[model samples]
Target chain A: MTSTNHTLFEDYLRGYISDEEKKRLELVLDSSETEREEFDLYKTMRRTLSPNIGNPYKERELKEHLEELGKKYTHEFSNEVMEMPVVRKAGYVRRILSVAASFTLVGLIGIAAMIPKNTSKALAQAYVYSSDSTAPSRSVNGDNLITSSEEYYLSGMQAFKEHKYETAIISTRKAKVGASPELIQEIEWLMALSELGLGNDAKAKELLTEISTDTKSDFSGEAKELLEDLNGIMHRISSFF
Target chain B: MPTAKTYLNGIKQTSHKVQHPDQKYIEALRTNDMILVEDIYKNYGQMITDLVKKNNGNAQDAMDLFQEVLIILHRYSQEGFTLTCSLKSFLYTLCKRRWINELKKKGRAETLKVADISDLNFAEESKESVEGTEMYDQRFRFCKEKFNLLSPGCKEIIQLSWRKQEDGKYCSWKEIAEELDMSYAYIRKKASQCKARLIELARKDPGFKNL
Candidate 1:
């Protein structure tokens, strides 16, 4: 190709050329196999240089996420298997009833029996926790009411596990209202996930930003992971569409 | 006798029905569905581990290979890739092939025992898909490295030109030039020159020829 043709090719690839110039360049490429080959290479290089394709930083983050998930599952799978039979048997009754009349009684029983003794342990096994410290367990009210902040937190976790995220958000927000400062961070982290589950990405992101900015927050590691995960998911969803 | 038009239409129809069962897995990977990913590990992790171990590899190698395959699938899914067979079979084929390639690279190909993989038919399209992903990844790394090597001014100009807003429109060169306090023609020429330099640097690598 001539020097002029090469410059035109570069200009065309950079999208700086006029329509007429593009047409002229295409005509030249269409007439010569060698020119066409060079044009193809230029086109491929342009695409490869684009920030959207095969981003190494995003790829690294995803790899780390997958590795963490693998490790967590490997450690938890055995325990989950042992617990599965018991959960299945007890969970059957909860699945069968849908009536409002017995709802409160069932919820109490579910919280009593369904909420495992080490509920936090189960949550830790199943999900990445932002904080290393566990929330102190408060006694459940026998009157089937959420009285203590701890009960409210547990209720939110239970609803979250059941994928009832909106309810989880409400209960978890209530837990945050009068909780000790230590527990407030944990509540905010769970509330972020609840917001994510409800497809309230902006709200979830806001919560994550708050958690991540608090240097002393025990949930910083988890908050960072969720924040990156949220960004990755949003980017992928946008790209897919 | 069928006409040429009918024959071409038949080919198109056959291509349309080549949907594979692993599409859901691909979608799950793209969406970063942890539950499905964990399930995949549960279902196929042992098989991959055994396959790697039986072929002079270890559990760690198996894990690495599995993650690499998933990463490749994730990358390809972004480019509108489709599966043409069961995910299990496709994954097994990819993992096995990659393991063999690794062995070859390490000069252990002579000692490699060919496992019986008659049941796993690696389709032509699947092979192309794997190769294409590898090529794209190779080129992407090369371009990224070269772009990073450019002067700071060049890098800044090139990046600004590629920056797209949330509305999917690129930031105009006029705006970029104004922000940078440079002439519009200079910015455009500089971006093109930086890109050309990147392409030139990438081409200097022998691996680029193969890609």
Candidate 2:
């Protein structure tokens, strides 16, 4: 039950009172049904509400009357929708369409047409987009890159997860198409897997050694194990031959 | 013994621990990162605007909250309080608290809990404080309207002279003449006239005493 000093409820953790104090206080207020009711109200109010407090802010922006909050905040946003596998395809489709349209516009503008001329490349680009292409690709760059597709690479990922290593590698290789050298790490892993499945032990060892040297993670652990297996096989083959 | 290089290394370690946040390329009114200030605006701006309307506030009231909310954040971070919750939830609560405090300060007596604020979290952190803030903002808007109804020359004089201090939370009057492009003697007389007019408006308002 609440005392007349119900204002404590305004503070964080309801002032963190002891259970004995709480019970004694409740008993005191319980003397009157009205007091008990007030106590209950405070208790209920506390439960229903969250206790975190204080304002969050930056001095510079507040002065300008909400000038660029939207632009600034979007950068901090986690890109949750893009992260979900279900929505990722949608993100890809949106990116590709946007990119295609951008390209077509760019191409036509090069010819000095202001009406946003249409182009076959744009149409082709849109056709192979994730939504219509059924090739299951994603972008190598951030979701904004549309002209070059990551559809085949994404398909490789799906294939590998399905334990179809050869197909996955093939798909991964296609994914690397037109990609910057800064990229290709993810696709290269898949490509190495393709070689391993095709019994190309030497190539697999080379790829595994390179990846493991650059970084170490759960994936690196797997590559190391595979390297050991292939090295053992090569030793046995040499001895027998 | 850690000498000049050692002390420098210690400072470097502490700096790394602190992540030396970036403050480059500030655009006007952007507040997302250093204090998690930008996200606060995005998540709460609409809610505050809506709350104002629901409780007899106008778009202008909504705009004021945006400025005030950002100001409060600046104050809190400058004081070095850790933010343990999402920006959305934190901002909602602060605005609500400001509204309630403002109303209470005005002496409006319907003893209402934060419950009346639908936007605020009833359990305190479950949701943002839109409800509570809206309630208070509604009253502040009422106050703003009353302030606006005063003589325009008076209003213009007051606003032109109004300056947000370093912290941006407290408003005070100083050098009104410089701000208004007038002389000290002229400002003194104009301020007196403005004060009386303001008093009369407050007297006539039903919510003024409560406010």
Candidate 3:
């Protein structure tokens, strides 16, 4: 190729070529197989050199997110399996069942009560507050004993309040093995709520299923109600198709 | 087979079909839907863990491989890749293949068993998709390595000219030249020369020829 053609190719690769120049270059490339091959090679080189060129910020964000996920999975899998006791508080049972019944009614009525006019705007409203129910405090014994799992659980709760749902779930999962049976319910519930906030219906459903099946837990009724609501939503979404 | 006219008319008449199931999973990754991510782990975690353990690897190794596979999928989707199979199958195959490679790298190839993969039917399209991603990753590494070897000035010029702005525009040669306090014409020539040097270096690599 001529020096002029080579310059045009470089200019084209760098996106500096004007429409007219591009047309001329296209003609040159069409006229010779060698020029076309050269064009292809330069195109490949440009693509290879800049894989994340368009969204470096997004790429960096994704890398950070991946690192966080790695830490979460490592912590979750590395913990020793502990035999959990099925401890239930009689005082909380009635309140929990009442809350569950209310939620079940909401689910049966198309979730209109729980869901606001704007679904995205309703995420913050869905935060599961400890004060929402008169249920006995599992984490608030007189001694106020704290374990590493409880610390992680509290941190996870803080993260949830900050709308960092992924961090909340990770931290809560890290608390799983160390938490007492009573605290386990709260941790699982919060983790499920975080999942719901993040649009992970399937995951949220799975957690809720586990919670509902553990009838001994204070959150069992509430979990069953939430699972029904999730099912309702899924059914509605699928039917929209 | 339908005739060309029939196909064209049908295309005009019909609305788009339901999205593939895997598309939802892809969207979950893109949007950072942690719930979906957790569900993915719940569904496939044990299978992958077992595979890794049985193949002379551990849970940590499995997690790493799983995360890497997800990253690859995310990257591929960002580059306009579409999945043709169920997410479960695709993920399983990708993780299994990666774990096998990892084992082989650790000189445990003799212990690698094919029984796990025997029942997993990987579609031709999926195989091509994974291979294409692998090739792109290789080329990207090779190019990055060669580009880093260039002079500082060359690197700056090339990066400035090629780097995309937040608004999706490339910085013009004039802008780059002004930023660097160099003449536009001189900067243009320098960029071309730098590019030529990079191409020469890349060409010298044996893998580049194969690519």
User: Is 1 or 3 the stronger prediction by TM-score?
Assistant: 3
Off by over 4 Å in 3: A1-7, A10-16, A53-55, A77-241, B1-19, B27-46, B117-119, B122-125
lDDT score of residue A178 within candidate 3: 62
Residue-wise C-alpha lDDT for candidate 3, range B83-198, written one tens digit per residue? 55667566766777777777677556576644522323542325655565676566667777888899988787777866777676777778888999999888878877777777
Sliding window of 10 residues with minimal summed lDDT for model 3 chain B? B3-12
Q: Write the per-residue lDDT of candidate 2 for residues B97-185, one digit (tens) a residue.
A: 55656556645323333344333442265232334334334544554565568787877654443333457432323445666677766
Which number leads on TM-score?
A: 3
True-vs-predicted CA distance for residue A131, candidate 2, Å: 20
On residues A1-241, what C-alpha lDDT tens digit does candidate 2 reach at each position?
2222443222112334576765555555546655444344333222211111112223443555354553343223311111111213357788989899999887855654433322322221222232222234544555675534266777766665555544565566667887555446655666666555433444556778887776733246555655665556443343222
Q: Supply candidate 2's per-residue lDDT for B210.
A: 44
Q: What tens-digit string does per-residue lDDT give for candidate 3 at A1-241?
A: 4434444665665567798977777766666666665556666666555545434566566667766766666545533232212234467787889799999876756745443333321332353653353222345333577788877887887777766665676788788886787778778888777777554555567777998899787788887766665556544444232
What is the lDDT for A7 in model 3? 49
DockQ of each: 0.10, 0.05, 0.10
Candidate 2 C-alpha error for residue B95, in Å: 10
Full-model lDDT for every candidate? 0.62, 0.45, 0.64
Q: In every candidate, how many clashes are there?
A: 1, 34, 0
lDDT of 3: 0.64
Using alpha carbons, what is the TM-score of model 1?
0.51
